[model samples]
Every structure is written in structure tokens, then in C-alpha cells.
Target: MAGNGSFWVQIMPAILFLQLLFRAVGTDGASSFSFANDCQYPVWVGVLSGATSPPLARSGFYLPPSGTFQLAAPSSGSWSGTFWARTGCAVDSSTGRFSCATADCGSGDVACNGRGPSPPVTLAEITLASPGSGGQDFYDVSLVDGFNVPVRLSPSGGSAGECRAVACAGDVNAACPSDLRVVVAGSGGVVACRSACDAYRSARYCCTGEYGSPAACGPTNYSQVFKTACPAAYSYAYDDASSTFTCVGASNYDVTFCPRT
Candidate 1:
């Protein structure tokens, strides 16, 4: 009996080793992303994966008021992508095409299908690190493309300071510059705001040519309008210093559109 007990203990270590190996192989490094629409009206959520990253489960979908959708990143590697809300979307009676008044991707369908949004969009961008890589996740709310709806990116399950939520829940369209305002035809009510670069393709506003460098390209009066409204959002091409945010060991992220606070 004593010899049998000794033999069992010796084999137990090997069994434990095999169990750990199987567990590691079975686990995929994926993160959950929850998209919530808090707007009074319905909004279509659009997603575009980064050039090197794999596409998420759903590229785009119609989200009714107070509705939510969730997606998981590919487990093969780190995932990078941008999410935006397309407001006032519907199937065109004439063309039978799906389109949005703001942030339309021009796909004529619910899925963006590898297409990016047309500017005048509020973008929530994120790059999630692979599991066990010891790398931090990077995320931000960008108005550099433009502003259609208020957005907030909130990370959960990370260390306190690094997991802080970043948001730009301001009414930018209301104060949009006259030249940059995107107004609805009937009511002439401003629905979106264009970035200076989108409004005018000047080298200065576009951050190209001599103004390409961050040192040379400072914020213009146009960008200041966006910055003043959404302080945490990226106002211009070179507004990286304050706009970028990072998190370590986060389990998931909640992206809310038309966030209350």
C-alpha cells in the first residue's frame, strides 16, 4: 500500500502538468466590447477593423434607442478597430439602399464590409492587446473625423487610474461652425459638425505639407471649437497628447452613444 501511494504521488505531478497545458491551449485571448445606444432616436452602429486586424463578428447593425450590441475580438492576435454611430439611417425607398444621414460608410448595406465611415463622425477607437502579452490596451474618443453624436469609452476590470472612462458627451452639433455644420434639409437643424480638415483641405487644417508635424500643426480656431465642446476628444490630427488613453488588464469595454454623463 505504501509503495502504491508513492507511485500515485509521482504520477499526480504529470497529470497536473497535462491539465495546465490543455487549459492554456484552450483559452483564447479575446475581449468583449459592448455598444450601447442611449440616444432618443435609433442609431446604426458601424465598425471598421484596422488594416492588419481581423474583422469582428458584426460589422454594423441597427441599434434602437437604449439598445445594446456586443462583439468579441478575434483571438488569433491583438485587435485594433474603430466604432461609430450612424444617425438617421434607413433603407432608401428609391434605391433600396441602407444609408445614414451622418457617418455613412457608403456600403448601401447594414454591414460596412471593410469600408470606413464618411467623415463628420464621432469615433471610438481601440487597440486591445493579446492575452498574456503584458501589453496595455489603448483607446480613445476622436472628433478628428468630426462629430455626429456624443460618445464615451469606458473600460472595466483594470487598475483604477488606467481603467478610467473617457468621454465626449457634449452637444457639438449645436455649436458647430456655420461653415462646418451639417444641417437636415427640412428643419435646417444641425445634426453633425465637420472637422476643419474635412471642411477645408488646407495643408494647415489637414496637418499635411509643412504643417504635417505636431510641432508645426497647432490647433486652429476651428479645432478650438471642437476642443472647447469635447475636451476629452481628439479635436485635430495632432491632438494626441490629451486624447489618447490606456488601460492594463481590462476585461471589457462599454461604448455608449449619446451618453447621459
Candidate 2:
């Protein structure tokens, strides 16, 4: 035939160069080993042996050297580290520090600046009294551990006077005053009421059990005038005008006594 086609084309180029020398020594010559330029030899040798990269994610919100991780408003001062994804982080207004650079990745607007100090306004503990000579004045405030949340005692002006007294006046029978001279304070001191008086004269002071009728003064006309002058021990008085009353525990605590006029 053409000498057997030149002996099968010289044995097919020596069996295709021994199958390219056993594929350069096999495992397909480690896919032609590479070194960079978009690397590719087992993923650039598993990223130079430290294996693949892309890790480091932790930010549920905790930047408290003093406070201020998100929008900055916890006294406006003191802050700390770890904010990566594109790096470029900074902030050190004198001492409230925060930094980033080494092996960074910290993405966008990584925050933190000079911030800290602003959250304090809670005052309560008032006291004022004129428990009754009359003009119906009484305000003795003190409430500790009594109102945990829902509280709204707003009387920026008049008539809030007695903070709405309720608690003693003979358990709601009303008509108080046995020389009612109450004066308790709170927030941490002065609350001596060792029975100076108040056996019961406080239905807000009078719906009468005795006190010169004007219906014994109840509908807030406030005149128990000390139950008509210390009926037995508790007395009440109010009359600013002819609000009407004659309660007289020896009458004279500066006597104006609720006549309301």
C-alpha cells in the first residue's frame, strides 16, 4: 500500500509523543500550573495556601468605647473598632477613637465620631401646704415608687394645688381639719406626720359632719370648716366669702378660711 502508509506515519508520531509524556507526568500536569495573571492552579493554590479568603463579618451593633455605633447619640463621645468591607474608616476627635486599615474591607460610611453625654431629666418630689384656714388651700406632694410608668400630673398653673388629695379624710367620708397642718416632702426626706392630725377630714375637706351648712360644703366648695371647729379632733374650714362656714378650733391660723369671694 504505500509501504503501509509509511509504516503508519512513523507509528503515529511515536504515539503522539508518548501521549505528551504521560500528560507531562499526570493529574493532567496539575492543569498546567499557573502563577497569577488571573491565577488558576487549584484556585491559585487555594489562595496561596491560606485557603480561599472572603471571611470576616460581625456587626450586630456594638461600638461602645463610650457609645455610638449607628447614628451617634449616646452622650456624643467615645467609640471603638472593627468596621470592615472596603476599609477607609476613621474618627478620633481628640480621644474618642476608631480606626481601620490593615487588611481592610469595611464598606461604606463606616461611622463614629466625638459623641457622649446627654440623657438626664427626671425630677419629682413637691410639697406645699396650707391645709386649711380656708381659701381651701392644700398641696402636699410626695409619691415614691408609686407610679412606675403612666404618670401625668400636669397643672402648670392654678387648681392643681392639692395634687388632688386622696388617702385620708377618714377613708373618704370627707370633711377634714383638726387644725389640718400637713407638710410631707419626698425624693428623700421630711415626712413626719406622727399623728399631728388627720383622724379623717379629707373628702377633699367637707361634705359636712358638722360645719355651718352651705350643704356643709362639698361640691368642691370645700368647707368642712374643721367639722365646725374641731368636732371631736379632726377639723376642716373653707369659705373665701360667704362660701359659708363657722368651723372654729379656736380659729386663728391666719384666718382667711375658705369664704371664696
Candidate 3:
């Protein structure tokens, strides 16, 4: 048998090669997000880096049916951002511009630049672990603004047993009340649903001013409807008690569009 020093020397090159590969992939024992579209139609996926943080990949990209896009985390050590799906997209033949009927970012093209999402969108949010915590990431599905599609956030090959997976996998559009429904243009069908705050725009529904505090902003009947439909998502602004999930030492995550069957 070779001595311990000799054995390590023989394997050092292989170990160094793996380290380089991991860094190139952007999951070098750190955290990253991978997006996939399972819908039968193309989907424009928008990525927004957290405020005060730098962006990783392109702001937006067109994902063909069953296509995938993987992005390594930003080099900023700790980062946070939101991801959403835009459907019913098409290029304006006359103007040669890209647009989507749902989750439109109002940039008049596939790329959203730095625009925030329009209402009636399902959002997946991730905040990587801080350096002090030895690396634990927080993730969630949020319907606080509303729901236009189903989304699932799953952690893969990581130290995330309790973290598990979270999804708002229901078609809230079909269940949306007439007063809160957003009908698509061509189909005239409910392709998206709005929150009570968005639909009503009242202080009560929006939890503003006197209702802004967590103690003041208890769940209302309108918010209960969304919570019942999506127990794992943030139904309203103050619905943070059970809506957040944490993963320790995770390698990467996969965010899926149209995750529900």
C-alpha cells in the first residue's frame, strides 16, 4: 500500500479538477436557482435580483416548451430575488416587439429589464444563506399580489429534509370570483386572479395606514379564500407565519412553471 502522503499526491489533480468544474457551474458547494418550464407553450421567465444586489444572468429569457435555464447565484455572497412566469406571449409582427398577456413586465419585450412584475402573478422568492449561518437558504411561493399560474420550488441534492418542497399548485383562476377575475383577451377566459387589495384598492383590503401593522392586519375573509386555495403561499402581506421555508447547505434549487397537473 502507498503511504498517506503518496496517496494524496496521486489524487490531488482529480480533486482540483472537480473544484474548478463546480465553480464553473456556479453551485460550488454554494446555492443557485434553475428554472424549467413544463407548460406546453413557450413561457417568458423573468428574474429580478434583490434590491441593492447585482444581477446574475439576463433579466428575462424565452423558455421554449419544456426548456430549461440555469443560473448560478450572484457573487455577492448573500442575495435575494423573485422569479415569475409570463404566458400568452407573442411577438408583435408589426412592431417586432415581445409581450405577454399575463405577468407582463411592461418593458414591451421579453426582457423585463428592472421592471417589477405586474399584478396577478405567481412569484418564487429566494434569499441565500448569510455567511454567518454557515449557509442556509430561505425560499417560498408567494401569491400575495395574486395568482396567474402554478409554481413549485423544489430543493435538489441538499441538506433540506425539513425544507422539503413548497408549491401553490392550484388553478386559482377557475376558483376566482367574478369580481376578481382577469379575463384573457382572445379566450375571454379567466387566465389570472387578483387579490382583494388589487381588486378593491381599499385600505381594509390593502392593509394600509391603520391596518398596516401585523397586529392590525389579521386575515380577512378575502385573504382566507386565497389561503385556503394555496396554504403554502403568502396569501396576503402579513401571511408570513407559515409561508417561509429554509434549507441548510443546499446545492441548488429548481423552480417550475405550470407545476400542477
The TM-scores, one per candidate, come to 0.92, 0.14, 0.85
lDDT by residue for model 1 over 175-202, one digit each (tens)? 8989999988863599999998998889
What are the clash counts of all predictions, listed in order?
0, 47, 0
Model 2, runs deviating above 4 Å: 1-4, 27-100, 104-261
Q: State each model's CA lDDT, in order.
A: 0.89, 0.23, 0.83
lDDT tens digits, residue span 169-220, model 2: 1211122222322222331321112111123443433334554464565323
Residue clash pairs of candidate 1? none
lDDT of 1 at 117: 96
lDDT of 1 at 221: 96
lDDT of 3 by residue, 53-123 (tens): 77877889989878999988764467788999988888899998888888989888778888878888999
Clashing pairs in 3: none
User: Judged by TM-score relative to the true structure, which candidate is superior, 2 or 3?
Assistant: 3
Candidate 2 RMSD computed on C-alpha atoms after optimal superposition onto the true structure: 35.9
Better of 1 and 3 by lDDT: 1
Per lDDT, the best of the predicted structures is 1
Sorted on lDDT, best first, the list reads 1, 3, 2
Give lDDT: candidate 1, residue 74. Answer: 70
What lDDT is obtained when candidate 3 is compared to the true structure?
A: 0.83
